[model samples]
Target: MDQDQTYEYRGYRLVAKPADNGARCWAWRDGVPVHKLIGCDVPDAIQRTRNAIDSDLGVAARDGDAGDAAYTRALEAVLPELSTGQLKMLQARYRAPDRIITATELAKAAGYSNYSGANLQYGNLGKAVHAHHPVDLPVRSNGTLVYTCALADSPDLEPSATEDDSHWRWRMLPSLAFALCALGLVAK
Candidate 1:
């Protein structure tokens, strides 16, 4: 077998390599294998890997559409209420190479000198949205507010001895991303 080629796309790390029949690819998040595919060729394998990742992220609809109508409407309803800083943070997350961003990175994107400002605004963003629509949002067992849950997916990580906000990461929800595009907040 030749050396495996790794590619990062939309927050997933894809590894592609040769197989007996043709090629194989795997999608990984935070170093854990989440999905796999076998293709007739290397490029096919890579494309299939990307498709799987996008489908899991909800960015790629299995039925050849952009998003679910109800979910997109729900996100659009809350988007108008987001502050400029929060919107910028979301845009930054969407543009991130791997689509994952930390609080400090979000602060920088939102023009805040400190992460605290971003943190506060993010929490408020989530609180407001959760107050109205409580479905499909991630919940934490610790009772602490995980603001990222409202609009983003958190990295899959083992619970550490101490939870650190500075190290936390967020990836924008696909539904929200599509809504943002529909609302002209970002390009489609």
Candidate 2:
């Protein structure tokens, strides 16, 4: 039987509808559709939505904030699980001005022939991070089970600045950046 489970987090209302394949989840803020996802399960759906709220759409740690400890720990836990391509993509974002990067640019930086590869790798990396810490949000698709979320800031939608700008551009969180530095994952 399909049941609609409703929840509230970070001032957003979440509804998860379970199906044969998985759960379809949605989040609304101030009655506006802010995000959606097809999660592997009901809890996964809700957790993913909560993750988005806790990290991406909310105020994360700023420079030198002690509140960043959780993000730092999560990144450190997931570091060993990242592939070279994934690490490269993260390094590129780390080196980018203000830590903001587009998927296409990240693909090129990580030596992937296409953005699709970068999306997959990055999304998978997001899963790894999520495994270590559920609070780290990874963007999920409303339509498919594809991993499009990267282990970075949720993403700032920049509409129509360019063909690429139409996509959600990511900014690396300060905690993740500092974690990379602390672990010597990126060159100083």
Candidate 3:
């Protein structure tokens, strides 16, 4: 098949031609063949090719290494069972480095009309973090939360003065008591 026979769509040149075994589609970017789509209809192949190109371009534009590092940290923080939306939220949070993110902001970015949906997603994220990490995250009255990267030093885990310190202390008391009991400093 002649390489000249190609179709351009969304900055990608697609060519459906004969391969050694069967017909396949080749997607080229900047005169370099980047992807091969096999065993799919022409439209499907074209869509897949466009998606691949878009994803590649997005990563390239966003500093792929930094995005990858943030994504990796997010993966470590969250549970294995995560939805794509939840994963995106976590990635955005991790990428921002010391920013306190709210469910409303995450929901807005995720294209949701209401914070309720985002709240549920954030709840899931919190559960995943608590289950996996040794530290408990501080939660605000408005349901906002903060997460610093694992590389951060001397993170302030203290509850706000306005917030009920008793609530926070109570939540951690069981664990603290257990440690004291283990050290024989306190009776069980």
1-188 per-residue lDDT for model 2 (tens digits): 48798888778899888867657789988889788975445654565566666666665432222324565677788877778898899889877865778888889988999888888888788767656655523334664332333256534545324555325577665556656666678754
Alpha-carbon error at 82 in model 2, in Å?
A: 1.6
Which lDDT tens digits does candidate 1 get at residues 47-85? 567767777787832222233344356557777787889
Query: CA RMSD for every model?
Result: 9.6, 15.3, 18.0
Give the per-residue lDDT digits (tens) of candidate 3, residues 48-126.
4554666777642111112223433444545457676765554443333232344455666566676567656656654
User: Model 2 compared with the native: what TM-score?
Assistant: 0.55
Q: What is the lDDT of candidate 3?
A: 0.44
lDDT ranking, high to low: 1, 2, 3
After superposing candidate 1, which stretches have Cα over 4 Å from the reference? Answer: 1-67, 136-145, 158-163
Total backbone collisions for each predicted model: 1, 0, 0
Give the TM-scores of the predictions, in the order they appear.
0.58, 0.55, 0.32
Pairwise TM-score winner, candidates 2 and 3: 2
Off by over 4 Å in 2: 1-66, 136-150, 160-167
